[model samples]
Target: MISRRLGSIAIGLALLGGTGANALLAPSAEADATTSRTYESLKNGSFEADAGWSSFAQGAGTEAAVSDLRASHGQRSLRIVDSSSSSAVGWASNAIRVDPGKQYTATALSYVASGHAPLLYLKFYDSAGRELDSTATSASTQRGEWRAFPAVSAWAPDGATHAQVVIYSLSNRTGTFFVDAVDLAPGANASLTANQYFHVQNDGSATPWGWYELDDARQAGSVVPDPTDAANGVLAIRPHVSTGDEWSGAVGTRFSASEAARYSLSMKALRQRGTPVMHAALRYYDRHGEVIGTDRSGIDVVPGRWQESSLTSLAPSGTVEAELIIGCTGTVRCDTLVDDVTVTPHWDTTFYAAPSALGSADGSTPESAADYRDDAFWQEVDAALETGTARVVLTDGQYDVATDDDALHLRGIGSDDHRLLVSGESRFGVVLTQRADLTTYVVQVRDVVNLTVENIHLTADGTYVTPSAFLITEDPTAGERTEGIIVRGISLTDMPGVKYSGVGVAGTVPSGPGVVDVVVDDGLFARGGSGAGYHHVYATRGATTVRVSESVLQDSAGTYVKLRDNVGDWVIEDNIFVSSGTWINNVQFIQWALYNTTEPGNEFFSPGPYRIAGNVFEAQEGWCAPQCRVMTLTARGYNPVDHDGVEWDHLLDPVKREILMDESEGNIETRRAVVRQNFNLALDDAHGISVTDNEYRNIDTLMTLWNTSDYGAPSQGGNGVYDLSNLFATYRDGL
Candidate 1:
């Protein structure tokens, strides 16, 4: 099962309000038909009304006022001046009624003329005047220029009855900042736009891009020159061992899916060497990252000739995604070549769309395919969902959602029960293009039960505006999260603005349930943002049980996958991480910061069952002058008082460290992981963790595992090891 072979350990992982004219406004011109784009902008959203907002200052020399010094989209802005050594200053809007469980995105423009970063918060309160919950965005980082401040997207908790938008900063130094165009809209930014748009275009080709070694180095798989035709390359699955597991020699790709549905699986394979028993199978997974069941090829292969195998089977119950495998098992040396692998919808209501097909199209077939550029296409999709699951099959062509304004190409699947599948002929066969900036996503999902976007290419020409290719998010209430989603078999290129995915899960609260049961498989995430915080796949604030496998991730400015704080139960396996690009903070290939940074005791503790097995980490020589690390499992925090008097030197003291672990339940940092059977090339070492049964080549130090808790410092002691081995890496000592 997936739990055994694929390394998946099952893990369990809005907004409000109302008002009249000031509380509810008409939909703007940019709002799409399906979106409840009607939003309640605070009476003083533009700071034009002097009486609707209350100003507060906590220090002697700090003050707030409506000033004409600068504005973004208005004649005036809220200015907070802190002339004292320490102060809290800003304006708070009157509380507005909100839906108890809906998400709201708090946005504003800020000019941090000097001093520290600004802060934006959406504070939720219950009907009894008691605070329920509050969420904040990243501190505003831009200075001088009037730029969009960080987002404070969050859900109104179960008891919340009102929400107040607070724009302020608690600074310890003298500074000034201006804020304008503030609004708290109900839903994510991408949820307010058209729900049927794509971001990049590709020259529809049947063959996908970026397939790499499947088994790390055991039974290698790569795109090698075709044995039949040297000029062309084919996927070569070479089984080095004569015999092993039933699914040993394999080449595979993964994609997101829905449960209890039949999928059409097919592939062309040729035996280039030994008479190995060719095998093809489909491994299905639940949103919890656990393997549910599998389906295999029904017919046997005819050796020494190209043969095609196809099968139809129902996906096991609870399956949200699946991997398509092509390979062989043998008692002797074997080599197999594969091509034209595909998995398409079999029982869902299917529609066809093509770029050039227009004129009263019905989307019944390719000849009558709906024109993707027309409103009718979206209407067609929106209508189909009123009944059951729907599949939109796109013909090979470029589908661009071009808009002149900064408005996002927000597309969401509307149903909470039925699934929606948007499939292309191949990963490079169909393309989705968006002309908007980084604030937008190629595909954004919120509150959907099951949705899959696969076999397509997403690109941004040179626009560094889109931060992710696919983003699954929701500011969910307690005990709820956006779940059962997949993004598979696609290519993301020239996406310099993407700080998250090829596929990312964002906007989750550390206190609330986060996005879970998500899978990102068989895609190419390359040449992305080189910014300090940018990464290929980023799961933040309680996201857990996510599986990222069988894909190529290359040239990230930062690391490939970043599970930042309170994320756990991630299965990252059988993928290739190629580091040959601009290096800003390329410190770790896959970093897991899985401990609670602010919470005391074990309230918000989330260590891990993080499985990092059967993968390859490769880097170019001199890419990171002193050499980069393969992976890191550390905390993004210092001593937070849970271990009151423990000093750096006392970390090694058994009694002291034991007290630290006991009081905190070892939640200060990443305390568990499985790092085995991996191939590290040109990687110098790992931090707070060691490896076993893994091959290393061209490494600087043979291998060094630090046993420290002070952010992987070599001089400190560790708390304990949480993996299967004797020494799991943590803060200060062994576990």
Candidate 2:
């Protein structure tokens, strides 16, 4: 269903990282594995205090102050009101000391009611309080409503120190923009040593967060928190620049200052995303304040790469104190961060997330205003879709599909907590029933490039009249067809109260600039009653690849997956199918290839040279009637109804009213495929087919090579039966 849902299966890429909670914590020497940790460094950064900050505003209005105005998170946010009549003007903050090379993040929450007017940026300064460079957030505010802006970033330079955070309006744009929660800090942990690794250890040591900047061997830079680069925003040490010392960069605290015969050190460093020519140095000092060793090791890396550097050096006999120092020197003016610096006597090689910043533990989630089946729910869904790429999660419950036009539309779902959006202990929610008579499909994906839907379950309202729960159809107006789609971690079961089980087609894609890959993995599709294409998955549009693996199918009509045109594919392996129905196949591939229904004969698209292996096919012995064939390949150009007068054609009524399915013809050689390494005794019969290395049991037919060309005949091999991937390894014992 390239026009509808047929296409290649493309995996929706992973979502972004979790909040600070998702950040890594440095590992403790005593623990067997790395642990997660978080720390707060902002000093009155919440705008709750008036003494720590100097606020001002400029432009036509020329007014700014910390007020009890609408807050972004906590109470009392900073409000900047400007006028359009005046020239561009703004306010600035007093300089905060920072060490060169130690990367610091500057972050602030901003809100603009109108167009992309006022912009917020950061300014860095050296020892004498001279300006060094200006940096900005990843993207500028667009003309929109009130919402939070992305985190801004910056890195300090060597000889360069001190920074002033500022906000202002450029020409042609002047409006009210609010700023709150300004935070600055290092982005990660670069190494692990004696210093408690990012303040995460509770090993009876104070977190050496306090750092000092030195010019000519004396302390110089003032310390403040950098808020922009850390997730959303966090606190950091801002050391003053001392041009006097090439090493006048920011310096971290001394954990386990008591020296040893040998010392090993490591830490992570980075600058802005694309800045070039940046460097950092790690130094070691002996007792009596004497320099013993310094690592001028060349740091050749791109910005924001978080490159880790390690060095081991032997100390003098009298080494009483050791100071691990970090300095930055780069021709490129970009914001940098230094995190997870470690000094250890023992060299332990390993990788770990930054223990300093929080990782995936903010514990905040999008609050649901309404259930997923309501108009309010669709409105929320529509808003997320507008972002081009969005992350959405459906909580557990039974939802409804009213009118056919009201199917749920999806674009993208974020990475973290997509499944955790549930309130308590529910697997997923499903569209159970339809409110309107015109409603056929429960979910119809129209036009999108790459999409992923996972960790969700579908349930019916127990209404027997309901057709399918999910369907992807053609949109004549959409020039861009879907390329890749992944549907995983889903489940559909018979309802407790319903009379006739709900029947659903699950999904389909259109034909045009057809589909590339459609993957259905790790799901359960059971008893979607006895309708047409109402089993697991059915695709019409020709897909370059179609994959279904690691799933379970039970209590459904005979046919399971009917996705044709899966060219050159991985095995449809590791599945369990227990059915009692007397159908031609548990798996079938037919050429319904309809490129453009409005057109005549469409070009032939090869479905697959598929490898169907590693599965357990059990046609329950008690259900009666003739045993169903495990695999069937037909070269038919039209939908079939088992020739017998008894077997009904459930697809006729639905297709007749919708698309012109009768007008399209497919390639006669669409029956090409392979089946091997399966435990099923029932062999499929078709042209250009290969069924080999399988076990035969209480079944009739072994191979039925009937019509079609380019098929691989089944090869004979092993006779033992086993399930795929040991999903059923201990299954019988559990039973």
Candidate 3:
């Protein structure tokens, strides 16, 4: 007798003769037309029967058999016990026929009771039964816990028609392991999403359902009944630690995860005893089982109280597996209880905005585009940014942005794991313009990360001199600093005037942290108010890893780039810094006043290893009348004479000057920098700069240090500029 099954329906064939001869059978036309064909290539994959598998033991004291002792799934598993220290032992599945040039993935669940981990492999064979190639996962070493083999995928080699699923113990191990629920299917496996939320049952068993000791060899613990609910249970862990390592006592569950996808984890934790802190966290691993990133929940678990902790994270690049870990830190003796763990993925959404669209106002599509003037539309955007991902798409039109506060207040939004993007239909078509004269910035972003603003034009009323076109600041309640900000393909301009034009794009170190990882690329920052306070790109203090490249910084009332105090690891390259008639003073293109401040808590200043290369500095003829310098580097008291004859309202008086010059240095020394491979066109001499490998056109005396008699030189080892070899690569490496 023979049997054939196609998708849940089976057909049986029986011979009418008594001789037991072979016979040909065909399906009826009606049956063939209505049914589809499928194949279960790997027979008895669940290890319910031992018929489709072959086992072997090549060394002394090795054993392999189908056992009902323990299993990851179903009621039975293939058990392999190895006491042999020099030979391999395990089971191999019957050959599963495969097509050449097609990819396949083999997945299985394994539980190691005591010993080294077993390795899973997919071995391919050619048409002649010769072995071709194989792919294997590293030994998964989370002992006494059930773990999925890191998925192994391979393409069938040329002339190959079959493959085998192999589970074997390494040559030098002495332990017992079980393999169950093995599968071999075409294509790679999908990320697991079904068993995200787990609840303990009445019998004190969880998913993959087993009660065992904690993974750490020294830790002694188990699954116990929940104190609050007698019907349910919780994972109870007690750390056995000789050191106070954060991961000293941890239990983890691994799942398949996609790279760059966002996930959130939440669980209820209770600290019962000891002085250690209890935490719920996640660790991401790559294909080779190396940990790539770890994110810990910020909520603290207090003793005797069940507190829920939540965390959101983005899987790093190249991540293949993610582990949810509950652990105790800071002490050797601690008891922690965890229950009701949930993991969720945050999906992405796209929003549309236009001038006249009004269908439902959901921002889901062009027909349902959000009205730009609707406060509810912006509110919805802000809400999406907090929890998940959002992309704002704007149509080509003028947007009237007139408000007393910032027009767009991106406050307490986004995170390092998820980013927000605002983009226009075209680079120069969408305009964000101020309708009324306001003193604040057009767009103010406070304590946001991974935000990108691009492909728009930002401007103010011709009469209103706003403080800044775009500003970045910190809100301590949200984060420590604003980071991962990008301003690309934008045109930002301040009100035009010599006396009081504001900055184009500015970052201020208010009372908290400053900005970092800021990139201004392929943009225009121009038309600023004159004086020492206004600039195209300005940072008062604490601007770390700020880069300005492939942009135009032109027609500034003050210097183009001004960085003061505690700035380092900066790059200014591939830019055009041109001074027009609006630039009246003899201001330089770049200014670095590396000064220290006594702002109570923030004091230290770092002498940066800086890089200024591959830029062009040009000035219009007869412009910058008094003098023109390419760049300036100085400390606070070094240029006191520049303020010697200042009038009232100069922001600095003689008494304040004396106090500033008399302040303590705090014993911080400045590090010199390199300015290389630049082009200076018709500009006056430079001060305190080491110009190297630069080209000059109609400019005399390009390399000039500050004179002590004429301009008050910087103190030795203080904000002095010089050239060094291979500085760009060095500074980039440090960043």
**By TM-score, who's the top model here?**
1
Q: What's the lDDT for candidate 3?
A: 0.56
Top model by lDDT, which number?
A: 3
Judge candidate 1 at residue 709 and give its lDDT.
41
- Looking at candidate 3, the ten consecutive residues that score lowest on lDDT are 15-24
Clashes in model 3: which pairs?
501-529
Tens digits of per-residue lDDT, candidate 3, 1-735, equal: 111111221111110001111000211221001111111245445554323455544467888877789865434688888988877786666566665445678888888888888878787765455567677775467788778888788866545557777777767777888887676876632213222222332233332222224454522244444455433245566656635455544444466554555777777778887654666667799746898998776456689777887777887755658876666656457677766566665557678888656688788887789876566776777677666666788887777676754266666666555567778865445677776766666667777777777777676666465676677767655545677777776666554532322223334555556677677776656566656666778765656667777666666767678766556556676565655444455547777653322212132233344556545455544555544555554433332211133111112334433332331333111112111101111111132222332212112122222212113332333232222211222222222
| Candidate 2 structure lDDT | 0.40
Q: Rank the candidates by TM-score, best first.
A: 1, 3, 2
Query: Where in model 2 is the C-alpha error above 4 Å?
Result: 1-389, 402-407, 411-426, 429-438, 495-511, 531-533, 565-571, 580-607, 622-627, 637-703, 706-735
**lDDT minimum window of 10 residues, candidate 1:** 1-10
Q: lDDT by residue for model 1 over 356-386, one digit each (tens)?
A: 6754588888788877655556666767777
Better lDDT candidate (1, 2):
1
Where is model 2 poorest over a 10-residue stretch in terms of lDDT?
A: 9-18
The digit string of per-residue lDDT tens for model 2 on 582-612 reads 3323332211222212112122323234555
lDDT at 69, model 1: 82
